[model samples]
Target: MNVKNIFAAVAILAATGSAFAQQTEFVAPDAAFQSRLTRAEVRQDLAQATAEGTTAQRQHDGQDTVYAAGGRSRQDVRAEAIRAASIRHYGDVNDTYFGG
Candidate 1:
């Protein structure tokens, strides 16, 4: 082989060797997969649960108001119907979330 061809081969070999050197291995933390969640994470979960509950309550109230409204054609009666339902809804508000 010519000297130029030999030099090209050596360069290719050197580049290939660098690829192996650049590789890295990962290791788990000292506690591994048994790590406990942080306090902030727990707080986040609780907050999320609370928000979800509130959203569900709102959705329920919306559905009840819609039902009470009867139909969209009677828009004039809708507000009155919802207002009347609020009286009973006050009593229904008794739940764990409200400290009941």
Candidate 2:
């Protein structure tokens, strides 16, 4: 063939070889398929966490949870809400569009 065709074929072959070379092998994790704690140890840890009431909340378990009370009192919250409501809400199209 001509020199141009030979050069084009070499270029295509070089590109294909470079593309295949630019790959990374899969690396397994350091602790692949292995656990530091046995099943019985895991069970014991779960039991201890349950006894201390530190376990994560599950979905729809039908249990009532009471959160700790905040520092603000009910009257304080009501007063803050009233003060906030009294402040004019800017850009409210429904009320006093001309700032009247």
What would the per-residue lDDT of candidate 1 be over residues 8-96, giving only the tens digit for each residue? 99999999998888537766567456647998998898799898885344434333433343455566688878888665444656667
Off by over 4 Å in 2: 1-57, 60-64, 92-100
Q: Considering every candidate listed, which one attains the maximal lDDT? A: 2
TM-score of each: 0.27, 0.31
Per-candidate total of colliding backbone pairs: 0, 0
The models' CA-based lDDT, in order, is 0.71, 0.85
* TM-score of predicted structure 1: 0.27
Task: Give model 1 RMSD, 1 decimal.
Answer: 20.4
Point out the worst 10-residue segment of candidate 1 by lDDT. 60-69
